[model samples]
Target: MNFRIISALVMRYLFLYSRSPMRLVELAFWPVVDLVVWGNVTVFIQKNTNPEFGSYVLFFLGGMILWDIMFRAQQGVAISFLEDVWTRNLLNIFVAPVRSSEYISATFIVGMLRILITAVVLSFISWFGYAFNVFQLSWWLIPFFLNLMLFGWSLGMISTALILRWGLAAESLAWAIPFFFQPVVAVFYRVEDMPAWSRPIAWCFPPTYIFEGMRDVMKSGTMNWDYLGYAAGLNILYLALAGWLFVWVLNLTRKRGLLTKFATQ
Candidate 1:
């Protein structure tokens, strides 16, 4: 966990983005599009529905923002690794003095920076475009956002591990894997709205509690720490599992001489 090595990796990613305009646009594009499309739909729903239904803008925008936190966090790590793979730089980084933990730490820091930028942009859009103040959610938003980021980072770790083990064939997992948890996360709906069988599975995801908690705040204007606690607990477990899996896969890659093989292909 040397800060110099970690900073070097972070600076490498920063330089990559700085040199590519498309990369910066791509980083902010999907999140803005998601907010615009869904923000308009939320306005439409609010116009037609009763007040008791709560703020559709908040509900929709909150979900989108939180979901993107996880998405950005996951991409921060997984895509950063994939960037190395695409440039055939993975072998070079690992062969250097970089430790596995340092690489991950750097990715996590980069992901946080990305998430912050995206979140700020989307939050302003939600406020001015939709007249929804996400910051109004107050202190509860802190843990909600952190929990989602942790879960996203965990998924990112697993995605990177799979890519390491399976080579380019597993690259799609970088983008597609997070979607697999969407339905189960109950992001846009309540946990009870899910099928009973799915409810059990949904509970396994940390975001389920966060979104449910968001809805609770919208309706009652009260925060539910219980949901946050449950989410935090689940995030810890998932993050630990992800870390172990990443290390195991990395060691296996070295033992099997897959790093060199992957670099060439």
Candidate 2:
């Protein structure tokens, strides 16, 4: 892929965000809100449940902080894609010199940057206010975070595909899709803790393994790279399928003479 094309596309978003103070605020605002609200709730629960289980609060708070990283990664792609959709610029973007590969790369690059910024902000809040430090995960943090990022990108691509296929009717998914996986992904509980019927669905997601590994680390104070491997494997599969689905939907939309008229629909 041409770096220039990717750079241009990425810069467009960076410039857009730079110009608007509210856009900058919006980037980190909701996450801070989530951290604050959930952080307090977890603390309250810890206080009530048992003071001896001090890690209980961090369990919930840490889960939430890590969860938001994936969420922000997804929003980076889905919401950035939506900006083009909302402005009726999808056609313009496609007709330009940019290739599909370059565009997708740009989205991922942009998404990665957005998530990193959000992660830094959340880390500070988590560290200072909650007395929780994500860095404590050490080397294990890399694989889990990377897998989650891949999963988030895959989901975002699928969401973009659906919106391209179904128009504004499917727009709500950009904001809502990640939440759909929250319960099933074992963010706060182990996959086995879920019902038998739901466990099948849970395993299909990479975050399920990552969280399982995460919980194991919390409970045992040891690294379990096996779960990270599972997560990485699932992420590879998820990413392949997501890219194929997006291209397939894009082709179908084009064949149906939908791209030119997608914005109106």
C-alpha lDDT values of all predictions: 0.90, 0.85
What TM-score goes with each of the models? 0.97, 0.95
By TM-score, the best candidate is 1
Off by over 4 Å in 2: 263-265
Model 1 root mean square deviation, Cα atoms: 1.2
> What would you estimate as the lDDT of candidate 1?
0.90
Least well predicted 10-residue stretch by lDDT in candidate 2: 50-59
Q: Give a tens-digit lDDT track for model 1, residues 37-106.
A: 9988888888888865646546878888889988999999999999998998987987899999999999
lDDT score for residue 36 of model 2: 91
